[model samples]
Target: MRSVIDIVDLSTEELDDLIKVARDIIANPDKYAHVCDRKKLATLFFEPSTRTRLSFEAAMYELGGHVISVPDAGSSSASKGESVSDTARVVSCYADIIAMRHPKEGAAFVAASKATVPVINAGDGGHCHPTQTLADLLTIELEKNRLGNLTVGFCGDLKFGRTVHSLINALSRYEGNKFVLISPEELKLPSYVKKDAIKSKGIPYEQTTNLEEAMPKLDILYMTRVQRERFFNEEDYLRLKDSYILTPEKLRKAKPDLAILHPLPRVNEISVAVDDDPRACYFKQVENGKYMRMALILKLLKEAGTL
Candidate 1:
């Protein structure tokens, strides 16, 4: 609990404890309101990450702690030739804990290597986004009332959807779970995800390009935008872009109890027609993110012996 660099590092007991604390925070915010009154959280964003940054700030604010942030690398000493490690060392002097998001893969590992204060990785390129994974887990448990034995469908951008990757890896350890990866051929789930997280374990899985065809069978549908910025050519982006959009018409084929999830700031990958469906859980997911962060902040501060 010293640093929340990865969800993979947390055991089942630890994960359960965190979820419990998060629930307690949601039910009784006043009990822990001043726990972090004298603390500070530093946000070091070496890249543009609006949602994650704001979520962390909101969580700390709810705990009555203060926050100091650098919006991006260009606005800070990072633009003046200061190394990330060097910047982290300086910020540690002023903050109780650090949360960083960087464009480079494994950048958080580099920061934690140098930071004296506990460091949480908001994201590190496409390598991982562990805190978001925590949020997703919290949302899933709230929406479904449980975690295991579900058929989860991952649709779109599986090729570069780090959230999808982290979620699959985390959920793979639970019992009676299966996966359906729906994406264009060019955007199929990565080999490591298939081999390391799915295929080798004999976890029942199927892959297809048709979202409509996949809908009928899923307990949870996790949608990700097609990530146009990751495209190399216009033809490729044009070909695969709309292959994943979720609309109400298409969703009619899905089970009534099916819960739809998304790592948002979504574009047209999800149609407005589907927003009114009781199954659409993205907005609720956003609120759940705050509760999860509240739990996380409490755990970290407690572990640091500050709360």
Candidate 2:
């Protein structure tokens, strides 16, 4: 069975297909209501999550499928010291597909190695989050009508933002895509990511400490909160947490149609006042997440011959 452990696991063509399916589901929801009538989705989240877990469950239910979930690590067999592989093998026997999130990097890869069924990595620490990348791709496609030939600015927590890392990898594959990395020096995009995903591809990218200066040039502004959970040092977290706050005044110089996106659970990085602005598409990102997740579940299950 195939498994998705990183954003690179899917080719650009496959991503386009998934996006098309998501848009089709959006336009004709009723037609896809019972596509997974007898299937089952098991959500194994070892880390705390609200959006990814619920979005997966909601997607399955909307497809007329059932859900089995392990909401937390302590409540699962992991509490008894069960390995992720063992958990995946056990869950594979009971569910048609598995969606997993864990705080440990490469944890999903370990689970995918053992699971007999298709495994979808929901999120795995600061390593990668392919599903979030799917949601992002859908949002970008819908918002801009194309993924290429546009400048995308990523602000905040670049070091630990899995969503940022994943999206950067995905977008780098598209033609004429430029990156403007905005973050504090401590939170700059990892050198390996820059070398492998951007520099190696010969894609042009600029690093900046100033968000406003990069605003006018961006077609898309992806804002990320400095993740507290990823930090071992509470002091470091506190210091970088409020690094960049997007307000209406900040958007005055940004393109009128600039799509402002966030993989959220915001702790004041984005002003509530910006929510009413037409440029704010974070909520639309949330809704698109469900649809993209629904599209992903359908594709993986069909590939696994479960549907």
Candidate 3:
């Protein structure tokens, strides 16, 4: 069974195929509605996330499947200290596929390695969030017309943003793709992401602390929340927090077609004033996530021969 642990798990052709499916789902939803009829999707979320959990549940339901949710760890076997592997094996017996979210790094990997059915990593700590990357990719294609040959700026919290790292991994293979990482020194994109994903692939990228300077040059400015908890010192958080906020004044300096996106439940990183702007694509990105995931459910079930 195919399991999504990381973005690198998908080959170039497969990525193209998945994107095509996602686009097709957006174009013709009614045609694919019955594809997952009567199938089961088991969600094992140790850490509660209302958006991701609800998106998965909605995707399955819209595709005519049933859902089984483990919303909290305390109410499940995990509270008594049952291993994740044991839970995976047991859940695999009942569901055709699984999607998991956990607080610990590599928790989804541990479960996927043990499960009989295909397992999708929803989010595992700050390690990786592949599905969000899928949604971002779909958003990129829709907003910018093409994924390749575009300058995409990932602004704010690059170091801890799993969405950033996963997107870089997936996009590195596309021809002429460029990345502009806009973050403070403290939240720079991690070295493994730089060396392993960007530099190794020979994709051009530049890093800077200035978001406004990078604005007009970008086709996609992907915003992420800069959390106070990421800073060890309160003073450091207070200083850098204001640097990343997307004000209307900043948007005025951007390109006319620039797509400002966020994987949101956004904090103060993005100003409320910018929401009225036509270029704010985060909410559209959320709705698109549901359709992308709807596409995903169909693809997974087809591969499993259950569709």
Give every collision pair in model 2.
none
Per-model TM-score, in order, reads 0.95, 0.94, 0.96
Candidate 2 lDDT by residue in tens digits, 188-233: 9999999999999999999998898999999999998865676778
User: For candidate 3, what's the RMSD?
Assistant: 1.3
Residues 1-307 of candidate 3: C-alpha lDDT, one tens digit per residue: 7788887877878777888987887778787777777799998889879888899899888777899876586467998889999999999999998989999999999998999988889889988888888888888888877889999999999998888888888888889999999998889998988999899988899999999888889999999999888888999888888889999998878999988889988978899999989899999888778877777777777777776
Tell me, by lDDT, which candidate is best: 2
lDDT of predicted model 1? 0.86
lDDT ranking from best to worst? 2, 3, 1
lDDT, candidate 1, 33-100, per-residue tens: 87789899998888887788889999999999999986576577977888878887898899988989
Report the Cα lDDT for candidate 3: 0.87
Worst 10 residues of 2 by lDDT: 67-76
